[model samples]
Target: GIGDTIRVSLTEEPEFEIPVAKIIANRYNNRKQKHGIKAIEKNPLHPFEYSKRASKEVVGIGGKNAPIVVEHDFYFENTATDKLRITELAKWKTDADGFPLFTFTDFAKADKISTQANFVLMNLSDFDTNWQDVLAKSQNIVLVFESKTEHSMAEHRRMFIELINNDIDLPVIIKKRYSAISEEVFQIYAAADLGALFVDGLGDGIWIEHDEQISQQRMINTALGILQAARSRITKTDYISCPSCGRTLYNIQETTARIREKTGHLVGLKIGIMGCIVNGPGEMADADYGYVGAGFNKINLYKGKEVMLKGVPEENAVERLIDLIREHGDWVEPN
Candidate 1:
């Protein structure tokens, strides 16, 4: 019985139930299906991993991990004149008969360059073969998420659940790409017990950030931060927040942002934001601590409270929330 893994938004914070299984890409399966080779015609014990997706394959010895003889491998080359350095590097290496073989990244723009070099020309589908391109196999998955819009979350979850309920027997693990070093991609990775995840650039994405210029140092540091984080623990605070609703009387967005900005350095604190008192407390039941917007313009601080605190100016909500968090408890390290 594979348990389902889900990407939950702290903003929406909706609870879902299902079993998770991670998906593994099978290179050996590619060899068998694409090249018509038996997974092991010659050998009996080759330590092959099998695809859990197909039931027919599961009945016996041949499947996804069976070693397939690879006819080609890709080498990347950047062909612009600015990439003269690449040519310089390739000059040191040679193909069969001691002739230099060049590589290219922009294969789409490689009409003239393809003629000039000895290279394997391939379509995008070649590298992206299903059950082949991925690095490893596992049944369970995790998804990294920041706040997604409400309708987006629902539709996304529904689509994902449908994908999960597919006939694939293998556990499929899902994870979000480009989580912050401050966020808990690693924790989620460990919690979901993932075998591998997609490595990526920082801050949602480099392209997601504005194309505006900044200091080289800042760019390098952020990039390094992302790279280092993909391989290390999240050394800062983990934050969760809610996107605001019309029921929101307070500045939910601003409040959530300030909490993230201020406490982001504090590791493993569980804070929550709810829009209105009607469903806020019930919805935020799993939160360690929370603030809900109450009717009559008051705020309900869920620090074991029965009555609510009167509304302060919206401008001061973040400050007051910070003060409240600091006053409520000290930060604890995640084990």
Candidate 2:
């Protein structure tokens, strides 16, 4: 279904050559007509507000904290890998016996669970009619899910929707396990699965379990990247650049590279690099700063929606944009 939607959005009609924007609009309108207004009214919480509320109910994950990136301890059991030492690895809290503090138990076995542990981990299937009694003794609950089918994202989303409908505000750690896949495939699969959840404000943390083939650092970085792309977290500089076209006035690729090279360390800053001003402002409406092509060898810089400098020479635009950032007290020294 999604593949068809994507294909239609990119392919031009043979007869009329309809705009991509209009095609998307028509598709959206058709869906609305099919589902009716009740579909829109059924959402219980706004996406932004949903995450805010979910964060508050969990301990150590409250006070408006960004969604955390959790590292699984799969490496600890493997003695062959010395790539990341135990001391340097990012891990969860452990008991004095070197065991995890929380207990991971199946839903069927939860009836005999003890309250000695502070945290309890359960699968989506653990949620049942008597779930309230089973979880009543725990200080915190962490829901975990793993898909058994190709529609993993949808299954994860449905689990979240069930929680919201039942008013279960426990923190959820979106966990996915991978093996026998290339690093590139893992990256795409993991991002598509977890990013879908986070973008809709569904997850409280992310936990990726993988074989030793994937480095520990790569997993950590992928988790952070997914959160950053979802706008749920900001751990690095964010660049919003358009694909250059006939309207472009300069080498957009080289310019974007130069801009990123200088400002890549400025965490939380959003920079938009546009080939032209036609759709630049509207496209990057949420960007904190913008560098748009104005005319031949000319540039325009904007702070928010307001243009701070107009018709700046292309040679001096990047530095001027940096200066503008400093003037606004948003610039920090690169470490």
The prediction achieving the highest lDDT against the true structure is 2
Cα deviation of 285 in candidate 1 (Å)?
A: 2.4
- Residues 1-335 of candidate 2: C-alpha lDDT, one tens digit per residue: 54444322111122333443344344344444342111222556564453543643443442356666666542221112322211211133322222223334443344433232133455445554466665555545545555544455666776666667767677676778878777866776788778978888877777786899999889999998999999888889998887756787988878998999999999999999988999878888999999999989999999999999999999999999999999999999987
Instruction: Look at candidate 2 and tell me the lDDT of residue 165.
Output: 75
Best by TM-score: 2
**Pairs of colliding residues, candidate 2:** none
Query: Which segments of candidate 2 are over 4 A away from where they belong?
Result: 1-3, 7-59, 72-121
lDDT scores for all predictions? 0.36, 0.67
Model 1, 1-335: lDDT tens digits are: 33233333344323321111111112122233332211322322112432222211211111332111111121111221211111322443432221122222332222323222232212222223442222112222111112122122222233223333443332211212223322222223222221122131111111111122433344333432442334322334544355555788876766677767766666545566778877777666666567778754566675533323456555555667666666767553334
lDDT of 1 at 21: 18
- The runs of at least 3 residues in candidate 1 whose Cα sits more than 4 Å from the true structure, single-residue gaps closed, are 1-234, 304-315, 331-335
TM-score of 1: 0.33
- Give the Å error, residue 73, model 1: 22
